[model samples]
Target chain A: MHMALKFVLLTLLDRERITGYDIVKTFDSAVGYFWSASHQQVYRELSKLTDQGLVNFTSVKQGDKPDKKVYRITRSGKQELQDWLHEPAKESPTKDLLLVKLLNLRADNVDVLLEELDRAIKNAQQRASVYSGIEKTYYSKTQIAALELDDLALFLALRKGITSITSHIDWLHQTSAEIKKRVANNN
Target chain B: MHMALKFVLLTLLDRERITGYDIVKTFDSAVGYFWSASHQQVYRELSKLTDQGLVNFTSVKQGDKPDKKVYRITRSGKQELQDWLHEPAKESPTKDLLLVKLLNLRADNVDVLLEELDRAIKNAQQRASVYSGIEKTYYSKTQIAALELDDLALFLALRKGITSITSHIDWLHQTSAEIKKRVANNN
Candidate 1:
């Protein structure tokens, strides 16, 4: 976790105190589409935040288990988050290995690449449906219209994921057909 | 300069024996849209490939200038590329810092976020136009129709970049409007 994930934790903490375990689960269920952090990374970042005095944890003792550390943002964390929110957005470097493969396309390898394209289209479809499931389970038309500010933010983030995957699948379909046409004509 | 960039370099070398300087230029002009590596990273990876015997270079002496190391793909490099092409494509990890920022949106700080969105839209528009210029410069309708295999692959890659930026701009417009409406209503 770096600058982005640091602020992600602060945003979550600002809303409500949560355990590291809960943060992991929350990310998988809600934020995984937009951002992801592994268990170790999250734990490590949590400690780093504590070291910087940006967050502190309280020990909550359970009946039979070890005491859990429930983390909450400090005042300085809120200030830091506010400053970051005001910073200019840049197009951060992103890698699309599929595009890299396309950049290296060759007739001899076209068949294998086509197979991979088919697999990718299927995978994108699956992801789109899964995101749709989450949208339906958590938000309805009426519910979305009436959501509070925090809920609305979450809803918008979800919408971005759904739209992106839909666009991706559409592009994949067109590209796959074009490649097949080119290869078949050559043969 | 890991598995993906390694293949990228090999792909370039497989096509022609070129200097490291030319490879850097090629990436900026053709491959930067999909994948990027710093100059240092490219040089380092080239050295690594040479050590692994996947790529070999020859020094060309100029009249008064320093010798240039022009590299070509070894037979083993071609084999490595073939193996990679056949392998299943995985969705490599990519981070969109913009999305991370969106995930952290709050009413109090949304004003700044909107400004960032505006900047992002303009930046994307500039990119879209730049890609269009490249497409026009390198490909015409009749020329595209008569293009050979390698040219077609390059054309397709350029088309992908254009389409993606268009979709991104569309989403940014809708999202910015929605965010503005939400913030206004709360105020």
Candidate 2:
């Protein structure tokens, strides 16, 4: 199960009963900047959660439109989310194939690794820029200029992502320089 | 199983056949920069791997000391490592309880939230400093400065981490200032 999705479900439950569309809208409005789930994925997860009895849904009809499903968290769902929250964090094991291929590069042409790193760095930078734009759109200079202490945590997470991506770009430049130096020395 | 332990085992296997003590030495020499495994943990893992037939060990008599067991990876072990390397990446889910409490500060004292954010910012800054040290130790002033394409990939990953932490610090400062401004305006 996706921990972030579970957390999102619990948070929605904390508020009053909401429709699937409403949950999607809320996520898009608030947590969407940090956590993203496509509408289809959200709908599918909602159904799964309902089947698991973690959530209950009631059909509501709007004028001339198909009946909409509204959801509320069950007591069991809340308990599960709480339990997960209190659990000690498991170490994140990341396997970037790019890194693996790079590790094997001494036996191959170095140009391949250089090209991949360049692409990867560009990708990271693009993501960072996109996240920055999302932050700016959500929290205006005037709005950020007026945020209360309680409201700042989300912004901080956004900043964390930005910081991480920027540092990655800087490191890429340095590493590229080092590789070039080694090649020259060998020649 | 700790994925870090697996990485350690694989790295050791990358070198020639070695005893458990030699594995520890290699870890201390190179991997210590990015990953750490206790001596006890290493020995235990080695024994477990041997029991599973993932590694073959040969008994060697030393002068006046207990017999030592030198280990080499079996074909099965290499296959297992390769399988693990090809596994899909798992998305990491992070939920900081501290942030949750801060987000709810609207129901409590604002001063508490401010103090919490201040403390958090300081902590993050300290972590960034540590990462900086790791970078200095691992990559600083190396003659082979240019990364071949593949080597560049690993460098980029490290860079991404550094950039992320630094941006986090910057976001914290901006958010703190925003909260202060809001409080002043409201008063």
Candidate 3:
């Protein structure tokens, strides 16, 4: 198993008792901002964690939906999470495809490049909206003071995401405009 | 072969006829900013590209050192790069381990978290210095106006990188200070 997926699954389970479906939903919404894993990957990791005795699950019969296993972190899981928390993490290298395109762009593809920039701007804006919603829902003023250290850490992570997306959108706009200006000057 | 690495290598070849060692050197220095691959991965890809007739290499006899393979992009390689430039790229999902740590932080690990933040700030500063050197060497005022479209694109990519690192460093400082303030308030 990839160490990242293991740590991420443990992180999610450490939050609250949740079904695999819930993990998938969280990955799609909140946790997905900083870490990405497919639904299948989450389910696979959940099974592995269970087998490893790191997480335990209870089967709940839903009225209409299929029977789901609601997973909770074990004592062992808590110990692992605590150990992982104290361990130093290596910074992941950047692997942005848009940056790759910009580095490799040709003069003939300027229009296509602009289209890509537009797409990126829209994507960043959408992410910004999602992040803002997370902030409002999870880090509201009334909730802020009541937050434990762990919650505060998650809030800080969310804030970092918001900042990152905002900066990215600004850079996209600036780059798009600069390219247009350069093209116009050439003409 | 990973498509991203292939395009990156082709992009490098498009700039100049460079030896394999030069590609490795560039990967360690400039290209490492946005993408990453090990030396073996790069060599494997180069061999695959050569086999596909997209890249060709000539043997160079050095006076003292061992012989080297100087690689040049072929017509097919240029076409592939152009095609790749036009294709739409997905926004690569963020996968930051520090953010992961923040999300999963234990209350007892606050001191370690602060240490990690300090480490990150130092690393970002080091990267910022390297980027500044590159900007000075390649994008000086005279070079900026005289840049060909391709060089201009590389310059724009570099500027985006600088902007990203600056934003990241700012976030680190802000989060660090905020955490400290919160700890004091709680006490």
Candidate 4:
């Protein structure tokens, strides 16, 4: 299955009945650590899933708030998710620009490559910091209260992101130092 | 702009001319660490890119070897790569079954989740080991040659992979301990 289908399946798996906002919020809170989907995309996917009979929606009203349309996964949706899991994962092609620039770096303009690498490392670190904060505030609280297994799984994913980012940052530091030494010797 | 396009562009950028085998080898050596592509997919993409004039190929004869068609990127290809760099990165959706199963774990089947987590951590560690080996081999050779700048960048990316994998393994260990504690308290 592609990304959109995965999101729909994940959304239903998280809760029994969730409005579109709830679905977006669920991704924001948990899956957003790794996978990101805008509200427009989520709503569009929800409509498509409903049309395909993979999910069903119920309209409910709050006292003063806007009417909420809650979605539930159908039997077919569960089957689709299972089928997807059984399929061998598609090998995703590498398309990272940082790697592209690194491969292109020659003897001439090494400084530009170094700068790009620094930028990538910093971006990764920023993302890691955000995930760390999310874990401390949300996942940690959930772990203490209900001990929900889902929250625990999400916490683990966040931990993965943090580790990945920290690794990038550390590598950046080492690489930058090495580049500086090379520049000094050359000059 | 897509995975296929990126792979083709990176392959062309690596050298002025390369056959399918050379492209595949490059992927195996470097891109495989961060991105993966199958031989079939690579060949198909090359054909598509050639048709689109993003790349050009010419058959050449080696000493007593089979004639091979080597590919080079066109000016259009460089423009495409630059355009893609300016676009915001699209985050791929996370679809880890091990995490999904863990989220649904009840007291009756906590062992299953534990086993899965154990397996996942093991796999991650194994990957980390491979990446570490590659880094060591690459750095040792490059250090002797005094190609310090390129060596530094390669080492940085390699370290990122190693650290990320180690983090996953650590998180798995901690999560397993937590699960065991919860099981004991419940009993």
How far is each candidate from the true structure, as Cα RMSD in Å? 1.9, 6.7, 2.5, 4.3
Clashing pairs in 4: none
Assign candidate 1 its CAPRI class: medium
Off by over 4 Å in 1: none
TM-score (chain B) of candidate 3: 0.90
Kindly list the per-residue Cα lDDT of model 4 for residues B83-145, writing each as its tens digit.
Answer: 554444443444444454455455655776676677777777878788878867766754733
Please report the TM-score between candidate 3 and the true structure: 0.90
Q: Give iRMSD, candidate 2.
A: 6.2
Off by over 4 Å in 2: A1-8, A15-33, A36-69, A73-109, A135-140, A146-156, B1-12, B15-116, B132-163
lDDT of model 1 at residue A131?
88
Candidate order, TM-score descending:
1, 3, 4, 2
Better of 2 and 4 by DockQ: 4
lDDT by residue (A116-176, candidate 3, tens digit) is: 9998898889889988998987678888767887778778888889888888898899889
Docking class of 4: acceptable
lDDT string, candidate 3, B1-187, tens digits? 1488899888889888998778888767777777777779889999999999999999999999999999999999999998887787877677888887777665567688889899999999998988989999878977787788777777877887888899999999998887787778877
Model 1 Cα lDDT, one tens digit per residue, A50-151: 999999999999989988999999999989987877878656654577876776677777888889889999999998999899899889887876877667
Model 4 chain A worst lDDT window (10 residues): A85-94
Backbone clash pairs for candidate 3 read none
What is residue A77's positional error in candidate 3, in angstroms? 2.6
Model 2 Cα lDDT, one tens digit per residue, A76-129: 987775555444333322333444434434424466556666776777687777
Weakest 10 consecutive residues of candidate 1 chain A by summed lDDT? A87-96
TM-score for each candidate, following the candidate numbering = 0.94, 0.60, 0.90, 0.77
Clashing pairs in model 1?
none
lDDT of candidate 3 at residue A28, scale 0 to 100: 75
